[model samples]
Target: MSEAVLRLSGLEKSYNRGKPNEVRVLRGVELALVPGEIVALVAPSGAGKSTLLHMAGLLDVPDAGTVEIGGREMGGLGDRARTAVRRREVGFVYQFHHLLPEFTALENITLPQLADGATERAAQARARELLSRVGLEARADHRPAALSGGEQQRVAFCRALANGPRILLADEPTGNLDPATADRLFDVLMELVADEGLSALIATHNLELAARMSRVLRLDGGALHPQA
Candidate 1:
């Protein structure tokens, strides 16, 4: 069996601690993602799905428990170390494409690789390859403003994978697309994930999409539970 690429154990988080308006988010949540597995995170709004993802992706820390990637614990790491580990081990995709309007699709993808120490030529080559995989090779030179919503998201996907991360954490990646566009982009996303043998934890409200993943974990009542 594939080893766990992500492990979240006994995690706890809250806002406005010790205040009347405080809201407790995660409550001792635990989750594990094995290599090459794609897991869906299903949760209603205000259930802290994004909060959990933020902790997992190292963008934020929980009040208690641990976040580990590839067997390395992340709780006490300093900012620079955490940033380095996150950059090397995790890729994040949000609901919005968030591509830079000034850069071409290929450049948007290439920039991440370059930031991660890849040579310019290598970055460009990888960008082209990823764009081709998503059927965006012909749109490589077009900026985000010139592309359709689906196309922009495809570029975002390419950018996420540019650094060869071991795990992907996506927050409603296809939420803004129309049903047909969402379906098509989802197929492309899964294909890319499978081809790379990477583990993914994706948040989505679409039950149909959730059902297609390797497994689904629903976040409710401040905890994670297997859905069927």
Candidate 2:
């Protein structure tokens, strides 16, 4: 079998480690995403879904256990190494678009590629290509405020994919949109992942949308359980 693109084993995380109000977010949480797989992570509010995504994307660290991307262990890597891996190998989308208010859609997408060492011309070209893929080529010059909610989220998706990362981790990516818009955006997200052959772990509260993914897993009581 092909190796897993992203894996988590025995992950444990707690806030306020030694305090009475401490909260344990993840307890021995584990997951594996193979190439081209789309996994839906279903969890209720305050269930640590965002925390899990952060750990997977290297935005945060687990108190115990390991995060492996493309078979390389991340727990012991230095800051620079972890940052480099995050830039080149992982992509993340949150509930909010979080686009820079000043930059145009195209610019927003181009910036990450530039940060990853691509030339200006290459970055712009890549940005244009991604916008076109999402059928937003004409809105490339529009700022986030100028676009509709759905459009802004679509642009955010393009931004996450700008670096062509192998793994995509999204936290309620379409949650802010209306149901109709959410459905449409989710379709685009799935298409984008498939076209890029990316392994994705998308956390969402919508069961109808979850049913469309390759597999579904539930996060409850700080652990992961495969959905039947």
Candidate 3:
């Protein structure tokens, strides 16, 4: 069996603390993703799917519990250390493509690699390779505005992969696309995940998409429940 790449234990997060409108987003939520395993995170609207991904991705700290990646505990890590872990080990994809409008698709993917200290030549090579994998090579020089919604998201996927993260955390990655486009893009995503042997936790409302994953976990009322 593959080693666990991501693990969350007894995670808890709350907002508006000490106030009447306070919201408890995640309570004791636990999950683990093995290397090369693709797991689905299913939850309804406002159910803290984003919160869970953020916590798992190390973008935000949990009020309680632990977030671990590659067996390294995240709690108590300094900001620079946590950021280093995030940049080196995790990749994030959101509902929105969130590509830089002014940059070409190739540039968007190359930028992360550059930030990670790759040489300009090496970064561009990796960017071109990933863009080709997503069938976006032809659109490499186009800006986000010039691409279709599906193409933009495909570029986002390439950008996420440029850093070669071991784990991918996606929050409703295809939520903005039409049914046909979402399905196609998801297939590409699954292929990339399998090819790279990266573990992934993707949140989605679509049951069909959820079923395609290796395991499905539903988040409701701040807890995670496995589904048949």
Against the unseen true structure, what C-alpha lDDT does each candidate score? 0.94, 0.96, 0.93
Against the true structure, candidate 1 reaches a TM-score of 0.98
> Which run of 10 residues does model 1 get worst, by summed lDDT?
1-10
Of candidates 3 and 2, the better by TM-score: 2
RMSD of 3: 0.9
TM-score computed on alpha carbons, candidate 3? 0.98
Location of the lowest summed lDDT over 10 successive residues in candidate 2: 86-95
Q: Kindly report which residue stretches of model 2 are placed more than 4 angstroms away from their true locations once superposed.
A: none
Residue 171 displacement in candidate 3 (angstroms):
0.8
Give the residue spans of candidate 3 off by over 4 A.
none
TM-scores for all candidates? 0.98, 0.98, 0.98
Kindly list the per-residue Cα lDDT of model 3 for residues 1-228, writing each as its tens digit. Answer: 765789899999999988999999999999888988899999889999999999999999999999889988889899999988898899998899999999999999999988889999999999999999999999999999999999999999989988999999998999999999999999999999998889999999999999999999999899999986
RMSD of 2: 0.7
| Segments in model 1 whose C-alpha atoms lie over 4 Å from true places | none
